[model samples]
Target chain A: MTEGEFKIIFTGPMGAGKTTAITALSDQECVSTDVVNTDLEQCDKALTTAALDYGHIDIPGASGVRLYGTPGQERFRFMWPILASNAAGVIVLLNGQHPDLDEHLSTFVDAFWEGGRMPMVIGVGRLSDDDFFTIDAITEALVERNINPPVLSVDVRRKDDVLLLVEALLCQIEVNELGLAEA
Target chain B: MKQQRLGFVGLGDDTASACLSMLKIMDGRSGISWSLSDPDAADVLMVANESTDETRRWEHTSKPRIVVYHHNEPKPSASHVLQHPFRVMQLLSVLEDVASLLAPTQSQTPLKTDLPPSSIQAGAEAADVGEFWDSLHELLYGDFPAAAHWYVAQSDEGELWLDARSRRFMADPLLLKRMMHHNIRPGVLRACNAPATEGAVACSLFAMSWMITPHLPAGLSSWISADSAFQLLRWPSFGSLAKSRSDLTLCALLTKKALTRDQVLSLSQAAEDDTDRFINACAMSGLMRYDKADLQTLPGVSAEAAGSRFGGLIKGLRSRLGLSA
Candidate 1:
């Protein structure tokens, strides 16, 4: 809400396009630590994001937004809570190629929040492969699990796509007045 | 013409022996360079242990057709071999796959070329050492899934801690039946029948470890741990029930058969540690050979028809437990 008072955390499994999507939208200096993901046994062939990635985005009217990307590996799940502290909101990214989207979402939601309520949850469905899932389908699946949060179909590489997501999330944050009193 | 060569870094006598075994069956066009102690000796680097920090360092250097022959641990970035003797053929098949991909070209493209070369090279005498390292990292790190596959393919056996009896079930199912016919219990049978695949075996072991750990509630968890035996049982053609839940599903299905509590306990007696207690707990939950027979009544089957059903249940249980000797 205030300048440098909060930040959006990009979290998801590896190769879900968190870094590329963040960099595309960021207008200011973006600090990122990206090691080429070396374990492709269970991931996409041409996709990788090894460690943490970071970027700063200046909203057209609101305060500049700082985006932090966490390592997508399950091994780094311990870092989620630490990053969630002093967080503006959370975007749980999905690879779309994953066979069990509902199961994956349940696992992520349970692991990320520990049943504790989290900030506004946004499901960013990165359309990969020819067979794409509609935003309504993804949102409906989330809603079944009581995760009736705003969901979006996004292309992390496009500035307009990221801008639209930022606007949608900001509007939700306004109605809820998230991170305002805390700041 | 000189034969195309492969190098080894941590190639010990054991690996050398295994490679020699493969070499015996392999066609004679390719050559191998053995490294007893030298990390740089081989045209193909073999790291049998990934936990040692040195393996990562080895990744930075050593430009050989790399094959990692180790169990799943931390260090080495590339391939691993299977841990079982039966899987040696499977491992070799995978190696052949990798070798075909990494085989040096006839032209042997130079170490440096135009941007984004499809193939990359590094040298001991090369001046572009920095560029070489970066290129090597990209070349190796970029294709990690392929490398990990090679690693799984090369490892001799996975890390499964089954006792002697359990190991026999895996090595030979008929032997398990023989032991069961002698009245050996299902827990002991399951302990011996852990599957060959690493991921499934690992998950089973993890669940088993929890089930057998000192203080947990015994039934469902314990039976779940011993589920690996069920995975082995599905070799020829699995039924609808077994396919649904692997171990847990099998336990649930067994409950529908309706055996007596004592019969379940008798089967449970063959199990070692908590696996038996777990089965006993399941029997108590009204699954398997255990049905609603009042323990207060006269012991054993009262009717000839009941005896026949019980006899059939024992046979089915024996086969399911890998005890059909």
Candidate 2:
């Protein structure tokens, strides 16, 4: 039997720290090529995850969890379906600096869930110390969208912090899987 | 909201046919009223002609209103229309220009504004008007890109697609011949010695420029035709292998700010290089510029954020080179 490996995908708008979040928690070696964006948006300063980033981390000896990060720019919207199909769950990273979190979430929903069943999601609220966002504030925003996806504050640069959130998300995924099996 | 009727004086039967179609479409819409008349019945006339005699005839007569649609071809007489009438307007390359001009009233809107209104102002501008000609060109096997090389469409999905492929056939008569030149399409070699159809040349050039334009010189940043942009990319001596696919260059240029003026000049002068020519065209067109104000207005990531991304890459490069941060 193939060892049970849970696949997770990371996505969000451009500049939302998806790559940083995955790298922080990934236990196995991760491969990444971060570069600047210079499209019409003039987003040259935004760190873009060029190719898909992958990390294989053991889920505390149960099995190894795999995480993949895809680019969030609209121009790359063509690749969303491929990423969505491979994912068992998702982590949406919000830049918090933006005032339109709800709009952003709606766009993501349109991109990933418009045609099929939505994936299990965990709303990772980035920029914790920033005045504009807090764990509670991010939670409320997710709940408003009927997402209620285990919203939590996450600094993508920290390994342990990202792990805590991932562990919580895995538990939610397990409960969801159990519910589905029973149904 | 005063509406006006449009006319064609000395316009060839082909352009007259296209203008007639545009008139029919406008007639169906509310608030804009229009009718197409032979030069005799028209209150406002749009004249397009190649013959100097035909052009001079329109010049002497002053209709209360007139717009000159000059059919610029490779023939030497193509530029002669410039001598006609200042009040004359060029062909409405896009329907939005036609609608806005023909709709009339209030402010004095100058006709034939060099760049199409879509790039500067945003409104129903709706389905690219060029789609009609593009499809027609496909049907007739006419070289559409060659005929309307200046038209660039800003895709609703926010990507750029080329309509005309003129840049492929027309060597940059304005530039020196020795520049390293090539078309800018991703993965395709620009310096192909084999002759290509004007359409293929246009398609390849546009595909390359659309990708390279985002990483163009600070002076150039807005959407521009691949041919024009290829001219700019030729300024930079250093050429990237990107072929302008998926805007990879934009990402790299914004993040790294890796290109130099000397490099830009070389690429700009590289007549063989399409990406270099394209980057230069955008910069020259004022569509692409380094204005912080314009940068702030872009829909995604802030200018400051974009700059910092470059700063980080520069810092990394500096450290590698043992230079001060």
Candidate 3:
């Protein structure tokens, strides 16, 4: 039997658009723990998420996806495992325009998959102009770590784009289930 | 196809031979072909080992030159410089660039390369074929030892089914090649829903392959044909398998329109193969999509509309936070 409930966590470094993505995809008005930004050096956004962003979406005849976004700042990283508890998959949102994108991706991938393996999908945002963090470079990074998750470009503000990430996660779950069943 | 005359200067016989082999691999794939010619008659000159006399001679010539240098050696200031022990794709890219510089008008043709015989024929010698299968099997299953079943969307005796083991499908080399090139995994098959009809299976296979391989088969090349329109699936990330800055430039240009290959090449100094490689890499990474329809004419979200939406969201946030905007 197919699973009915999926809890997926959205994570990445600062300015990755997690909050905006949750707000875009959430059926209910998203619940965000955002506060006035104090760390201007870290990010230039007016506000920053301090705790988590919460949302949910229901798909007919399949699992209802519960979306959670982790605070991008490292100070609140203690909440990562807590939010990721019982997560069916992970959606890592990265800022492609950031100079430190490759390092940020490596750090997050290490953190998320440290204890165990989980299916992941990487969504890169703000990839306008001559951005350096490409999908293949991200894929290469993941492949280097023996992780083969799907990497895509996404404008998190678009609901359809966010949905695509969720759908990809669900597909990953189904694939994992089949592998287990066959095994 | 028009043959592009190439002249070699100061290159060792081994390096020259290697270049010829690389050209052979790239032959019939692109509109341009390469043939050795006299220096004066050549459209492009390849220089190696820093032969001062030869460099001096070529300096007066109008032909575009590609300098070959050792990795540790200081690369010459040339329009193109290929490192020693270059990969086939890298060499092809340089050649394409030189071709574009030589004859801009002729470079617009959609590049196509002939597939190696080893990639297609399933009826090769048993021992040689077995070795190929073993290598491919090792690549796929060796990394994931726990993956017991691999589902392929190919038919065997009209039976469309999953093969739990690689050895069970040794007779089908094409399937094995696909598995290797596409890096096909159990996840792909499950996501695609295996055991479907033949057409569905082929479509799924193509979709999955496009998501992986850096190169597409000839059959799939039409999707990005020079006349057909294409759009980026998403914005390009610098992290792509793209080998040069021109590739990224092409990627950025592609995001705004459903451009043809000729249009894309004309916009940037990137050659057809480089652009093709960039497109294929983007497609494999799920960054682009191609269609026959011209999507540029379709209505899209305006910058003003997007800005307004963000502006409203910020205003609401400011109000909620009791902050003046």
How well is each residue in A1-183 modelled by candidate 3, as lDDT tens digits? Answer: 124655779999888988888887666898989899998866788988899999876554444567899998888989999988878778999876554566678778777864325767788877532222245446655655655566777788877567666655544443343222110
lDDT of 1 by residue, B1-325 (tens): 1333444545566555555544433332123222233455544455544335656567665354444444543444455443422123343344543454456441133222222432232222232222322332233223421111110101012122332211100213332223222322112111112234332211111122222232333333322333221111111111111111123222322221233433333332323434344343233222223223444432333222131212332233224323322
What C-alpha RMSD separates each model from the true structure?
25.3, 22.9, 21.3
Query: Compared with the true structure, what per-residue lDDT tens digits does model 1 show for residues A1-183?
Result: 444344777787776667776776556555666565577655645545555677765433444556888777877777777776766567777654344444556656665543323444444444431111233345445544645454555666766555545544443333232111210
Poorly placed runs, candidate 1 (over 4 Å) = A1-4, A45-50, A58-63, A112-117, A121-134, A178-183, B1-325
Tell me how many clashing residue pairs each candidate has. 41, 57, 15
TM-score of 3: 0.40
Best candidate according to DockQ = 3
- Top candidate by TM-score: 3
Residue B87, candidate 3: alpha-carbon lDDT: 50
Residue A44 displacement in candidate 3 (angstroms): 1.2
- Order of candidate numbers by lDDT, starting with the best: 3, 2, 1
What DockQ does model 2 achieve?
0.02
Model 3 regions lying over 4 Å from their true place: A1-5, A58-64, A114-116, A128-133, A181-183, B1-325
